[model samples]
Structure formats: structure tokens, C-alpha cells
Target chain A: MAGGGAAASALSTPWRSLLQRALDGNAHLKHSTFFQLATVGGGGRPANRTVVFRGFQEQSDKIQINTDARSNKIGEIRNCSFGEICWYFTDTWEQFRISGFIDVVDGSNPEPVKLQLRERAWFGSSVKSRLQYLGPCPGLPIPDDDLIKDAHLDPSAGPVDAFCLLVLDPEKFSYRNANAIPWMLSWPSILVCYVNVKAGGAGLLEINYGQAMNAAFKRWLVEVNRKTGPPPQVANGRLHIA
Target chain B: MAGGGAAASALSTPWRSLLQRALDGNAHLKHSTFFQLATVGGGGRPANRTVVFRGFQEQSDKIQINTDARSNKIGEIRNCSFGEICWYFTDTWEQFRISGFIDVVDGSNPEPVKLQLRERAWFGSSVKSRLQYLGPCPGLPIPDDDLIKDAHLDPSAGPVDAFCLLVLDPEKFSYRNANAIPWMLSWPSILVCYVNVKAGGAGLLEINYGQAMNAAFKRWLVEVNRKTGPPPQVANGRLHIA
Candidate 1:
């Protein structure tokens, strides 16, 4: 584990716990690991594709995703780092929409911890998966003889130049207030934090329970907010149910 | 069916057959109907979510997708009509990336044919699915009592104000040349065409089969292009395998 994501680690744990709960609940389904990732493409149009979630980076809230350096997404991220991940847990009937800036950690990155993370990601991948990167550039036409080149590949070698790791540092999490509150109400939810890591990780935890709730529920939200500590920061969009 | 999309009906049939084959092959899986739609949001950032495909509009290539008028996606589409759909067929191991401009047809749309399409989409939806629009505004805080309002709703009524039908008029279809060519090889593939409907349906069908494929494949592409009976117009990016 690297400390590069220490700033993002300050994000409140309740949302992480909710996500973990969903992951645990849907552990039986292999499809649970896949999520849709959206990126701003050329001409500022939107491009989206399904991607496998590797996991959270180290212990931070930042999401880790593996992509080929030669892929269109790599170019898309280079042009614009803004991205969003929409993950739906079928068993829990919960959808997490995380919008953030992605930090591309490739061979060009200077940070030692990031390089280590990249190495770890490389070593963690199966040999079959790693060999795909050694083939011709993705999305391009394949050469006449690709099979002959595979025999010379070394499985134990470090990640090739094409292996790139994307760390999405979440800036905001929006909850469809109605859908989120029902699940959190069971936990007597109060805290609604918007972790703005882009602000140098000064976590802005806002406890906003709208006036729509009943008097008793409002009182509980206030009571829980007082007990949670740290004053509310600048307001952002949407209620992030904890 | 309404004939508003008659102009786009000029798209060649081979590509349609390929997509049809994938759909027919994966008809057993319910998840096969769901695809990822990406739209350019505010600040030109990409926003993506899983959307159910309602199939092509009548006999044309235009994709029909039902959405709520109150949804952020509706607003995003209004801001910039450029959108892209990436659909992966698990059974066939095929991915289709179609980029186009979306036409939003709500109560405000004056076109009679478009209105008929909307009505058809509304009537096609399940009663339970249609009832959701009758509820509180989505993404907003729900009031204390919502269940009481559901009993008085008329399920058979015409589409509510929130219900909207989106017609994506595809301009370009991209293929990961390597992945697409292998599958299309079985069909003795030829003719990669880009249909540009944005030119008021002048239908710029560009036959651009790249030189990356072998000589036999190149000859096949030329023969197919000649048989298709139209001159290639306007160069575009990425191969569109047929």
C-alpha cells in the first residue's frame, strides 16, 4: 500500500462502508466487478465503455482501473482528466455515481509510489491478460501473423509500456435523495459529506437533511450531526447519504 | 409505423444483419437489452448511465431510447445533441460504438410523425414502468408521504409530461479493426460505410475499408463496394465492418 492517496483517505468511511456492503452482498455475481466508465472524448463529445474495477487505491477512496496505454481512453484522459464511474449493484439495487479527476499513472509518471502501484498492478494481472498488451496496438487492424509473436513473451517480466493504471480521485458523489435516504434511514443517517480532494483534501463534510423529513427525523439528523463533529463546509450539489 | 426516418433507410443491409445476428444470438439473456449511453454534460464533461434499448425506430437505423424529461440526461442532450452508445454483446463477444446526434421528442415537439413515435413508445412501456413518471420528481428529496399518491394514478393515460422519447440519429460507427475483422471474416467481410445523417439525410456513405487487411480481403472489399452501387463520399475515422 502506498501513501500517495493519503489526501483522499480523509474521505468519510460511511459511503465506503455502503459500497463495501453492496460488494459483499453481491460477491456471488461475477458481473458485480464490472462498471461503466465515461470519459470526455475528442471534440468534447462523451465516450463510454464498460471497465473492470481493480479496487480502491491503497486505503484511499480513489478508484483504481487498469487500461491499455494505446487505447482511445488513454488519449481521451490525456485531453481531459474529468471522468465519471456509474456502478450498479444488482443485488442491493444501489447505484453509485462518482464524478472525479483521473490521475494517469503510466511509465511517464515521476512519483515512486505511483510507479510501485503500477508495478503491483502489472504483476497482479494474469499472464494471458498481460500478453494482450504485447500484441499490436488496440483498436487498430491486427497484423497477418500475431500468433508467432506470442511464444517469445516472458510472463515474469515487468509491465510493458502499454500497461497504464488510472486512479480516479472522486470530487463529488451525488445521491438521488429519495433512493439514498430510504436505505440510510435504516441506519438513522445524518452525515452527508462531499469529499473535494481537488481542494487539497480538505474534506468538506456537510450534514444537510432537507426540510422534507418529519419533525422527529429532523431532530435525529440534527442530533447525529452535532455528535459527528467538524462544522459544515461550503455547500455543493446533492445529498450524499451516509 | 411513422416514416420520419425514411431518409436514413438508405443504410446497407449487411451491417444490419450483423447486428441482428448478435441480437438474435443473445435473445435469451435479459441483460442483452441494456447498453451504456454517454452524453456530453455541462462543461463538456461526459456523463454515462446504463439505458435499455427500445430497438431501432421502425425500419431505420435510428436508435430509440425512452427517458424521463426530468432526468439530467434530457437536459444534457438539449445542451449538446452529440451522444454515443457503446453496446457489448456478451454471447457474441461483439461491441458496437455508434456516435450520433440525438433528437429529443417531448410534448414540445411539433412534428406529427415524431409525436406518433413518442406515443408508440409510451404505449409500448409496461404500466408499472409508466407509473414511475407519475411519482415525485426524480433526484429530488421525496416528501414524507409518497405511497398515498400512487393509488390515484391512471396507468392507461397518455404519456405524462415527464416521459420522453429520444431518437439517436447515428452519424458514425467505429470498429476496433482487429476485433471486428476477425468476426466479419466468417462473412467474407467487405464495405465499411460511415452514414452521416447530420447532413439533412443526404446519406454520406463512405466505403473505407482500410488497407490493413490482406490482399484477398482488399479485393473482396472493392467488389462489395462496386456491388453496393454508390460512390464513396467523405472520409471518416475507424472502419465500419459490414
Candidate 2:
């Protein structure tokens, strides 16, 4: 019955509250919005880089990120939409690991709604930002070591063909606060318990469960069920972070 | 000839200089050494977390990280040694992405030299740091919501069975500085050129070439060769960050 209740609740609201609190606490710092995004690169290796968080998608919980369509990440998302984002807030000494599926909305996306969202995001972007798409394709060697000149894109120009808006629909979330308890959450069925013994500045242990809810995750679920024989409190309907 | 020269030179010295400069510039900040490590998880999705850099291995370029053998990363590395580390310096506004293979040295490892390295690292660790290994298996839920009691591991004891030393043998490195030009390096053969246009506090373009040196990387090499007809200066073995 507790498992059924957890499944019924689906998304965890308490985790969201905690994340919002961290965000609000560190909103004054510009770098607070910067986070590392890791994706499966060619040959199944991990590729990670910093990405700026564009606020949540209009009226929805999905995280928004504006990126160039010509970047390698676009191809990476095409091959495998699964991605993980790690964000650390310096002021609060808090860290968040969010794993999810990234939905790429580029010019070629068939969905009209996604295209409209892309257009709206493009209009919201400054002209200086839009001019980047007009430059040579990213990652290509500039011929003859020439410096890039500024482009003359109009301020009112629509979103360029290379503009893409990525929407990350989160499935699993993990939060760690140096001053408080660490909490983890997953949608529908999966749940994880994690502890990091940070005696010095270094973290001693960390575990990640991707949204697919792989074998280890399933095993963890069974283990939690077996260990907590008396019906876990959070497992019953309400999500708790304490 | 330039390609051969680059191959002969192997590791780029200029990139190392830049990294050392960043390290020296940010040595006062404790979190300067904290970086995000990304690895492939179950179902080939990306897993990322913050890890403290233990410094370069003894007389080697390999990055050192102290971890628990019982952690999920040990298993992840066993499954696939390929991993990437992204280090960002807040004060300097610089970022480094190092891609490489991880060499796991656990209690089960038979190599005496590596074992000695592990022992030396253990001796270097603080007593409070060593006590983490004595705690319950990480990521496993505690039965009945019980808190973890302090572990009383001896300061002079040898490395525990769960203590592991991860040596990341870097094959490719990318560096970005907000105040200067971005540079990239690869060992012996591969070379990558990347440019990120930052506008309004957001990076518009970035690229990653994993160490396996996949197809896209091969094509980039050819493109560089064809474009720079007069033979690139850096390709002539002298590592140049400019």
C-alpha cells in the first residue's frame, strides 16, 4: 500500500520546495544558475560541460536551456535524450543532481507547440546572443587563425535556424546540504538513500540512479522494502525530506 | 612533418602551464579543487557528481582521487574505465574538462607499486577522513531511520579494504578562461579546436572530443589539415595555447 501511494504521488513536492529554497537563497549570485550537464558522448563515454539554466518552461516544471543546434549536444540528445545535471550553490553549500530526459526543440522538430516555445525563447534572447548563431559552426577550426568578427543580426530578428531550446523533464532528484540531511527522490516507483561523509573538504561516497531505474535501483527498492518491514513513512503518499 | 612533430611531442606543455597558472591563482579558495566527475551509468546514461581533486599522482600527470571501493563509481569504473572530469574555478572564471581512462587501485589489485601508492595515500589521509570507510556500506539505506554513529578508525592504520585510489590517465584536455582564449589538447595524435562565444553571461558554443577519438574527431583533423595548407605551427610539436 505504501508503494502504491508513492507511485500515486509520482513527483515529489518536498524536494521541489527544498530546491526553490536553495535557489532563492542564492539568487543574488549570477554564477548560481550555472550547472554542469553530462551526456553520453560518442563511443558511450561521458561528456560534461557548464550550461546556464534558463528558467523553468512556461507554466511547467521542465527546466529550460538555450543552446546552439550545431553544437555536439544536439546530436548527443538525438542519440540519447537521457542526461544528468549537477548544480552546486556556493553560498548555501548545497548540491543538486537532477537526472532526466532532454527534449530538443529545434527548427526541424515536428511538434508545432515546441516550435512556438522555441520562437518565444528566441525573441526573449538579446541580439548579442542571437549573433552567435550567425558565426561559423562551433568546434570547427577557423581557417588561417583569423579572429571572429561581430555579426550584424537585427535586434528584432526571429530565432535563427541554429537556435534550439532544450527542455529537461526531470525524473530523479538528489539534494545534499552541508548543514542538514541529504535527501533523494524519484518519480513513480524508484527511491534512493544516500550519505556522504564529508569529514574534510572531500566527499567520501556518492551513488547515482539514472531515470531508467536500472538493476541497482530495483535492487535498492527491494532492499528498502525488506529492511523497513513496518511500512516506511515517506513511502506512504506524502514525500518527506527530513 | 607538423603532424609527426605533434605526435612526437605527445603531451602539450602549454596547456599544462595554463592549468598550473589557474591552480596557483585559485590556491587560496578551498572549493577550487572541487570538480564534477562524469561517468557512464546503467543503460549508458551519464552520471555526474562533485569530487575533490586529490592532486596529481606521484611524479605523474594522472589526476588522483580518493574514493571508497564500496562506492558505486568503483563498479562504474570496472564496467567502463572511461570518465571525464569538469573543473571550474570561481575566482578565475576558468573551466577545465579532462577526459581519460580511470585506473582503480583497490584492495583486490595485485600490483605492488600501485598498492604502495595506495598505502602512501592512506598515510596522507586524516583520521577523520579514514573513518568514513569504517561506516556502513554507502548508498544502502539504514534500517529503521537510524543515524550513523561516529566511526573510530585508528590514524596510523593501513588503508581499509574499501579505500580506493583512482588515477585518471588523461588523454584529452580542454581549457576555457573568460579573460583569454580557449585551448584544447590531445595526446600523441588528436587535436581539437573549440570556440565559445559568451554573450550576456551565457556561453553559446562548446564542443567535446572524447579520448577514443571517434569519427567526428577524425573528420575535424582532416578539416584542419585541409584548411591550414601551410602546416599549423602548433602541429609542429611546440605546444602553443594561443
Candidate 3:
């Protein structure tokens, strides 16, 4: 029965594909509130913050987001490209967590592709101001503080040294969905994509039964289990995000 | 002038003593809405999650909180008795991120400590119940589903196993405060207690400047930076959660 169920799910990829399409069509991503981004650095420790999804391209697995070049994250990502990105859809009780390496793209390059990105940036800024304020300057009137000027000033020009473009290429992806069974259980079952970064980007995807998903959901779980040559640990409880 | 600033912030025995008092004081610890608890399995990676502080004991460095026994965190600590605990205070932009191992005290044991903790739990539950849910539990039922009754019931038995008790014993600690000056420069500093977990739990507390504090703060900054990583690479920037 389990095998048949698995096969049925596999064959129903068109439905899943359509669902994915609908999710991508979601207007929330354009509003910069749909995704959470985390970066790991300073000797491989992980740190996370939220970011907006600026844009996505299907043909090339690359994402584009902007940041201050002077922000500590630029240094962290330069040191270690591996980081985790999470997208939570509350309406659907669904979360997608992706881990990948990032590369900073140069926005000023005059190449055709780069030009296209620059044009998109102009449109992006027009739609929503992408400037960040560095807190109000003291002594100066709050209105007098040139926050936007400081944020968008060219890094090479010495005032806004933090402005830069960030590009991320995900290697691993995991999807979790909350399942509600009448009078039985209300918890999420997860489907994980374990990308073998060193293996030419081949992914091992697994659908987890709720109880057995905890350790498997963790990044270190697979490594530790393999090294120790033991069956994975499984526990029951809902996972909470802080 | 620099030496004067360093000297002012230096940890004299009296200053250390005062900081310790603040840590122990119920009013100081309970002032914060959230506190971070970090735990590690023996030879395993560290895990951190925020938990509401129930209270603290000045004499024993004992802290109390509620947790589900089924949590993977409980299992992690079950194997490894030592861990770190950190409490953050954002109002003053001051934080005390402490490091310590935990000892799970037996609640059923007839120790005076157990009685005190039970009383606190009773009081805490009363307060927690009144607070509206912290975050939207999307897809949560308006009326929670009750557990199905067992065919055979014991009259004398109480409520089925639900909540569990957790007690933390802190060992090492770090204190951080944000300092901003006029113009465009600001630096956040930290005093970290590098606990010696290996050699009988004795170690030096070092004051790391510039890079170290930035690194510590980077953990909190990652989420913000992610808001800025590249745009989503997936087509339509969405993941189908199933």
C-alpha cells in the first residue's frame, strides 16, 4: 500500500506542478514579505534574517536580491557561500527551506544580461523604494538626514559603500506541509531534497512520515547517522520556529 | 582616552558581582519577553531555541522553564548534560547570553526545589493561558480537538501525559551592549565567558573586541541580511508544499 501510495504521488506530478505554479504566482513574493533568508559564516556558525524575494528566473537557477555592500553579511557570504533560505506560506501552512551557495553579481557591468538586470532594478526601485536607513543622525533634524542618499549612494563613491547585488543558487530544498486529520493529528509531514553539492547537483528527495522526520530534517542528521553507522533517531512533537 | 573607556567597561570584581546579581534577580531576568537556550549533544552540533523564562534562583544558578519531553531538544540534552543559556534584553540594547549545562531535576522527587518549581509552574500556566496566542497558528482549529478516550479508563488516574519540566544550570556567560556615537560610526561590544567544558569546567573569560562582537551580533543580523540575498531562483518564486 505504501509503495502504491508513493507511486500514485509520483504520477500526480502534474497536480504538484500546477500547485507550484500557483504558489509562484502568489502576489506576496512581490511585496517582499514572503521569504526568510539566513547566512552562515564567522567559522561556519549560522545566522538568519528575513529578506524579500525580488525576482526569480526559471531557466537559470539564480535568484537576485540587493544588499548594502558594507553590511557584515557581504563579508560573511564572501567567506562562506553556503547559507539557508526559508519561505513560509502561512495561508497554506507550508514552508520551503533551501540551502545553497551565493555569488555577488556586479550590477554595473554593461553585458546584455547585466543590462537586463539593471533595467529590472530600475523597475524594482520605481515599484518600491529599495533604500535602507542607517538610523537617524544625531543633531540633525530627522527630515534633514539623507537616509536614502546614504543607502543608495554608490559604494565606489565613498558615501554608500554598502550597496551591492547578491545572487543565490540553491543546492538543497525541503518542503513541509501541515496535515490536518479529523480528530487524529494536526502536524506537518515534510518532504526533503538533499542536494549533493559535490555530486554535480544531484538531489536525494525523501517524503517523511511525521514521527520520523525530526532528525532527518536537520542538516547534520544525515552526516552523523552515516558516520556513526546507526539508524536515525526519530521523535514526536510539533516543530516550532522562533 | 581609549584606555579610560576600556577601564570604565572593565570587569572589576564588584562589577562582575553586580552583573551576577542582575542575572539572579527575578525582576531583571523576567523583564524580557524572550530568552535563548542553547544545548549540544556530546560530540554533536549545537542547537538554540528561544523559551520564555519562568524564573531564576539566585543561590544555585538554577533556571526554570516548561518544555515538551518529546522535543528533540530534550533528547539532545538527555545525552549531553552540559549546555549554554543566554538571555537577551532589547530595550536597553543590552544582552546577557550565558553558557551553561542543564541538570534535569526529577519533578517527582520530594526535594524542596521541586515544590518551589511546581508552584511557579502553576502560577505561570495561569498567566500564559490568559495571553492571546503569540503568533497566528495558521490552520489551527477555532475549537481544539480533544483526544479520543481510551476504551479502558482508570478512575484514579489524572490527566494524560502532556507537559514536562525543564531546569537549567548556567555556567558560562556573555554580556553585550550597543554603543552608538555621533556621525556615521557605531560599534557593538561584548564580554564573553569562554567556559572550559573540557578541563573540569574551569576557563577564562575574555573580552573580544571589534571582529568578535560583530561575529556574535552577526547571528542576529543574518535574518535581516536574508531579506536582502538574491531573489528566488525558482520559477514564479514559489515552492509547492505537500
Top-scoring candidate (TM-score): 2
- lDDT tens digits by residue: candidate 2, B1-242: 11112222334354555566567667777677788999998888888988777767655567778898877788888898999998888876778989899999988889999999999778876665676576555433332233344455557779988789998987778765543323333435444433332322212112333435345445644554454342233455544433
Candidate 1 lDDT by residue in tens digits, B41-95: 8787778776778878876788888888878799999998888887766545556
List residue ranges in candidate 1 displaced over 4 A: A1-12, A90-92, A139-146, A174-242, B1-12, B139-151, B174-242
Better of 2 and 3 by TM-score: 2
Alpha-carbon local distance difference test for all models = 0.61, 0.65, 0.40
* TM-score of chain A taken by itself, candidate 3: 0.52
Check candidate 1 and list the clashing pairs.
Answer: none
lDDT computed for candidate 2: 0.65
Q: Supply fnat for every model shown.
A: 0.55, 0.60, 0.00
Q: Each model's TM-score, in the order given? A: 0.69, 0.73, 0.41
By descending lDDT, how would the candidates be arranged?
2, 1, 3
- What does candidate 2's lDDT look like per residue over A161-180, in tens digits? 87889999988777655533
Looking at candidate 1 chain B, the ten consecutive residues that score lowest on lDDT are: B177-186
lDDT of 3 by residue, A1-242 (tens): 11122222333232233224325434353321334455543444434443545554334445566665555567777776655565544344344555566775445545766545644544454312333423222111111223223434343221122335677775555443432211111234543322221222221222333334443124333433344342111225322111
C-alpha RMSD values across all candidates: 10.7, 9.1, 17.5
User: Looking at candidate 3, what is the lDDT of residue B26?
Assistant: 31
- Candidate closest to the true structure, highest lDDT: 2
- Cα misplacement distance, residue A134 of candidate 2 (Å): 1.4
Error of 1 at A118 (Å): 0.9
lDDT of 3 at A188: 48
